[model samples]
Target chain A: MAPTLCELCKTTRALIVRPKNHQKLCKSCFISIFETEIHNTITSNSLFFPGERVAIGASGGKDSTVLASVLKTLNERHHYGLNLILLSIDEGIKGYRDDSLKTVKRNAKQYDMPLEIVGYDELYGWTMDQVVEQIGKKGNCTYCGVFRRQALDRGAARLDIKHVVTGHNADDTAETVMMNLLRGDLPRLARATSIVTASAASDIKRSKPLKYAYEKEIVYYALHKGLDYFTTECIYSPEAFRGSARTLIKNLEKVRPSAILDVVKSGEDMARLVPDEVSAAGQGGKDVLVVEGEAYRAGGCGSANGRSSGGEMADTERQLLESEKAQGNETEISHLGQKHDRNCKIPNRTLRKLPKQQMGKCVRCGYLSSQDICKACMLLEGLNKNRPKTQIQVSVDEEDNSSRLTRRMESLKIIPAEQM
Target chain B: MSTQSNEAGMVLLEVEFTGGLELLFSNQRKHKISLPGSDEKGQPATAAFLVRYLCENLMKDTRKEMFVMDGTVRPGILVLINDADWELEGGDLYELKENDNFFFISTLHGG
Candidate 1:
């Protein structure tokens, strides 16, 4: 077979046939075009302000390593004047996070950016290993998801930075859209599709600069450029549902490479149709809705790197739907004055509305929460109280005991469901 | 073709796996394997033949499904023949040449 010349350069041999458009290009042309598109995403979205400090959420994975390298190159070339730093979260999972963190440390030196490491042990007095040991692996993703969201915020706060950029590409966004769509969670779907998410309640802002880049292109960029990255799956995350969704997206890409971007665009279009009242009520205390005319961007961490799996979410959705159906049936029975009226149909308007979430701070730890105690504090309370009786006598700090008691009392109060 | 002849009618090629695919191939990224010049039908050894050969001989890990599924390279894994996408090189039917380099990278793994 004769070598094909690059379509763009028309001189060098074409090495990559881009997945999104099938535009064939040589190695150098592909790299420049990839960087140019990311720069375009940043410029068109105005993702960064000149002379603003931004933190790259580094995981030493392919997405992030490529993000750092591209951002650095673009910042210099376009004179974006952004102060970039690498911020890493140590989940304290042995043989997993430990190995990835080493790659992150190397990336910090390779990129010549300052790096900050925050551990769950120092922040919450429990590493993920300890939490998994106590809570078991079944629903630990929720703990990790909620904690990592706040940890990134706190980590940025310690550094006094307001914005953090993640490596969530179009593929991740599409997957999140599918998950939310499958669960029929429009509010979260609206939140998940935005390129930028900011909360009025907090100073930290999160955005995905690679929101438009295809995963295939990103991997090709890394390979062609020789970027160093780690590639192991989290040992504890056999997230069945997400794994399934990912497979679906990949298969769709195989059949039609444009399906990913189409899904992302569809997600954004559907987000615009979400009612203001529903979106207003979706924000947890820490995540305020940013409504700009018909455009609404709410703050929430993307589950791309977080361990939150679709299985737990699917279970929650099932329970919610069952309860709602039961309520609808009961309403029908009460209005019709019949115990078993199978013929009577429940009106769609009669479906119970999600309760409006209140914004407040945890009384104990002072973190943002809808309840008097935040999720981390509630989890800590559970962990602390469940400590073996023998260890309780050895280290019963008064501060810890008093907070535990306060949280216990708070738990007794009738707190609304879906506090987190 | 005569100049590229190898001992015992076998063709030597370089194969590499990355993006966690190496974990299945004895956790080794690169390997040099010699393949018979022709397959069972006396046709030139193709990428399909190389895949089966690797799974049967090179792969030590029991999880064969991770690398290949239903007699083809998994959907999410990309195959590069001589640094060009295998899709451009006639996909699985591309005939192997002596000293040809084949790279397989899995995009399904966590980034």
Candidate 2:
């Protein structure tokens, strides 16, 4: 076969066939176009303002490495005047996170960005290794996921940064959409598809600048540019239901490369169909369920807002209640009627009947929580009370049983039912 | 064109794996392999044939499913032939050439 020229340059040898548009490009052309597309995503979405402080969620993996490289390049090239920082959550896994965090440290030096790492031990009083020991590795992901979500926010707060950008690409977003759809969590589907999500308090905003980028391009960009990145799966989270969805997405991409971005677009479009009342309830302090593997590292992190469902509504609803109080008796009666309508729809199993979640402060950490204590705090309380009598009881012998543990985790049926 | 005679006409090729797929191949990223110029059916060896050859001959890991699925390289794995996408090169049907570089990168790993 003869060599083909890059479509963009029309001179250099084509080295890449882009999945999104199927355009062939040379190495230089592909790099420039990849960076340019990311620049466009940032600028068009107004993802950043000049002089804004943004934290890059550095996982030391290929996606986050590419994200840091591209963001740094774009910031300097376009004169965005942004202060970029690398924030990593250390789950305290002995071999897995310890190895990856080393790459992240190298990435920080390579990219010339300041780095901040928050560990599960410091934040939640239990390392993942310890949690797995206590819980037998069957459901430790839940503890890790919940802790990492807050750890990121707390890390950003310590840095006084208002926003954190992650490396979630089109593939991750599409997987989340599929996971939510399969679970029949429409409200979460709405939140997951949104480009940006703010906590109920609206303090820190989380965005995925690579939300539209393909994972293939990310790995290619890292390789062509010679960026140092890690490439190991979390040893503890090798197999989960999300892994099945991930495999399905990959298989689909093999048949049709466009399927990944198509699923993303479909998710975004479907998000609009969710009733306003449902989205409102989602926004007003409901605890959004966290997707395993999405939180600190690759876990979906439950829609990026970090709220749970079915909690007492906090300030937002109290404001509504007070406003109703000021209105005439008839308006007050109608507000109550509206509440009854939503509550009664639960029996009918309708989508609009969102569990009324109230935003409140964690009694322990004062971080926002729908419950009196946040998930991390609650998990910590359980671990602290059940602290193993003998230290380091996490048997090394259990290492051989991880596959069995994953199978047990799958059978745990923790996946919320369609109706919840 | 006897099958035994084809062994004398082996072609040299370079194979590299990245994005954690190298773990399946004795944790070695690069291999210089010599292959029969043609398969048993007397046709030029294709990428599909190279995949099977690598698994059976070079791969030391017992977990073959991690690299190959349904008799092909797993779906998330990308194959590049001499720096161009194998998809642009007829994918599994692209015939192996002497000294050609085959790069397989897995996007299935965590990021």
Candidate 3:
């Protein structure tokens, strides 16, 4: 308990040294105000959606593992009213994903939540190794990112989920802001500007519950909980550019301890809030409810280029009608065949006739289908259009054909009928 | 000594990846840093590079903001600088001057 001769008193600014990169705070300061900000961030924003299914995309790493672990804790203590579920997407990389997958599974078991794991190999018919072979490393992030995003959306849709929660933290957000700014990606900048507001307008309404949480706090939480997790990193991520940003932040913290937080705040500030004028696209501008007609409501705010010049678009039939009404000009609006009535009540017996074959079972996704295949398979196949030109086994189980009839009686989670 | 500014304040910060959620940080002059995780040494290229960038960008005169590496694949690994999490508060914005200390750590997910 001997006091250092150079130590400063509580009131002495002269004794204070700017904390270095690795130093979080002084011992006395650590006890005073560590997690106060995090508490304020969550309570202030009401981050969690009420009585809705929240799927945490768990990667089993410190980031995602920490996220899932803390979310479960907070949900219980705070009663966030979330129907939480664990979602793990396996990109099917060899050395990288194998061990990490184990951690995700272990975490799922510990959390006592039902987990839905969608594998890229099975769903998209392509793995990272296969992707690397096809396009090389030169822009694989584009492919992986797109495919991964679509897959998450497709999976969430199949599960009837309203929101997808990710484990992105402040550092992640800041680096992204920098990367986006560097690349001049205005669309993404305009899209992701919202921290916890209007989360529904985006494709899947991804929320970063860890938006304000720090990596340090997350680690402390895990360590304090003695949570067993996979500590290794993805096998193929060494050459990524995000590595560069992490380095920059460290050096800056030496001089300005608040650099990382400043960067993160800047990113948060950069996000554009959705204006109330463009608000009609309610329900995140997406009526994911399978209630019919409502599906077309999704794209009203998708993009300016896609909409008709007159702010009206119609089918060829509608086109024919419009031409007939106004021969000289193409200004007439046509609303025929619009799918806006998706919610119109249709009794089970009145549903569209399944092309007899669609009543069969799909080889992929194990769902019943009106087209001999299931929607997941159709989408997965479409996504794999450029699937590595490698040889595919194309294996189909012998029992599948015979069991297809029996699939009707079985209550498999996904219905087999697929969209083209 | 007169009221001269502390010039040796430069920490020559370096963060090393020890293992998952574990990192080690030390100025070039320190023989050893007791930070937990891996028994690693010789600044990781990404960690060192980031520290350098932060230094120049933040207009820092010293390497006081050096952060160790937590096991993250991407470059944005969170470092505990001055006990204030770089991931939480203004990460690089955390100021550093003479006598100031820092720590680095990564995010955690609940079980």
Candidate 4:
């Protein structure tokens, strides 16, 4: 086969045939275009301000690693005047997170940025390993998902930063949109489609600068540029519904590469069509922003970390479905009336008065919550209650203290274990 | 290197796996292997043949599905033939050449 010259340069041999547009480009051209598109996403959305203290949610994985590298390059090239820092959430998984955090530490030195590490053990008194031990691996993703959302927020708060950026690319966003669509969650769909989500309840604002970059492109950028990144799946992740959604997205991409961006565009268009009252009701009016961040953050963490097996959205949908089933008759009658009369104010008023969650501060942790105690506090309560029993069990086996000591040492070791 | 000149019916190539796919290949990122110069039908070996060849000869991991699905390289894994996307080089059907570099990177791994 003859060598194909870059479409843009028309001189050098093309190394990449872009998936989205079939635009052939050499290595340098592709890298510059990838960074430029991210720049476009950031500037067009007004993601950051001059001298803004922003935290990059680094996981040491490809996405966040590429995000940190690109942001640093663009900041210097465009004079964005951003004070960037790396904020890592240590889920404290024995073999997985420990190794990834090492990459993140190196990235801090390599990028010349300050780094902060927050662990579930520090914030919630329970590491994910401990949580999995207490409540088995069956539904532990719920605990991790709820915990990481608040972990990121608290990590940012500790840095005294007001903005956080994540590495959620177009593929991740498309998967979330598909997950929401599958679960029939229009309100969340609306929230998930936005590039930036901020809440009045919390001081921090979160955005995805790589929101439009393809996963393939991100990997290519990291590879061509020789950016170091860790690439291991979380050992505890049980392939959940999101896995299916992800497979579907990849298959669709194979058939038509533009399908990803098209789905994102479609999601945004659909979000705009969502009724205002429905979105308002979705979060109890003014607290939609915080809840929006929660939902969006959970979607990313759920898919990226593979932490949430059923996903937090799926869990919430299940609960909502059960409750709706309980009041099925009343809702069915109201629905029938509304169908008969599109302008029926009585049904609308009753629906509006259906006891929406009023956002407030958690009494214990003082984080924003619709319930008296925030989700994290509520989860911690359960884990705390079970802590003593596990300790007692461990104490009962104290005659084997030497073996137990070795086991503890093994778990705490930083080296990646041969087997998960 | 001396064996390469003596073996007329074999081709040597370099293969790489990253983005977590290395875990499926004994946790090694790079490997060089010599393969048959032609497929079962005697046609020049292609990328599709190399995938199957690697699975049979190179891969020690039992989870074959992680690397190949439905008789093809899985969708999320990117294949770069000599630093160029395999998509541009005729995808899986591109004929293999001696000393060609085939890189497989999985995008499925989480960030």
Tell me, by TM-score, which candidate is best: 4
Q: Choose 2 or 3, whichever is better by lDDT.
A: 2
DockQ of each: 0.69, 0.72, 0.17, 0.77
Q: lDDT by residue for model 4 over A289-342, one digit each (tens)?
A: 122122222222111111222223213222322322333243233223334433
lDDT of 1 by residue, A1-420 (tens): 688889988999888988766778899999998898788778766789999999999988999999999999999999999999999999899998999999999999999999999999899998989988987886666567657777888899999999999999889888888976775556567667777777533468899989878888889999999999999988887566667778888888888877787677667656645544444444543233322221111212111112232234323222322332343343233333322434323222322333335657889878766567766677777788874222221111100111222222233322222331
Candidate structures ordered by DockQ, highest first: 4, 2, 1, 3
- The segments of candidate 2 whose C-alpha lies over 4 angstroms from its true place after superposition are A286-356, A387-420, B1-7
User: Candidate 1: where are CA atoms >4 Å away?
Assistant: A285-356, A387-420, B1-7
Docking quality class, candidate 4: medium
Question: Candidate 3: which stretches are off by over 4 Å?
Answer: A1-39, A197-203, A272-420, B1-17, B20-111
Native contacts, share recovered per candidate: 0.61, 0.78, 0.24, 0.84
Query: What TM-score should be assigned to candidate 1?
Result: 0.80
Candidate 3, residues B1-111, lDDT tens digits: the string is: 111114532334433333333322322222222221111243322323344443344322343333223422223244544333344433443333323344333332222
Candidate 3 overall Cα lDDT vs. reference? 0.45
What's the C-alpha lDDT at position B38 in model 1? Answer: 85
Residue B68 in candidate 1, Cα distance off native in Å: 0.9
lDDT of 1 by residue, B51-111 (tens): 9999999999999999898798987898999998887777888888889999999987666
> Worst ten-residue run, lDDT, model 2 chain A?
A392-401
Per-model TM-score versus the true fold: 0.80, 0.80, 0.51, 0.81
Report residue A414 deviation for candidate 1 (angstroms).
Answer: 30
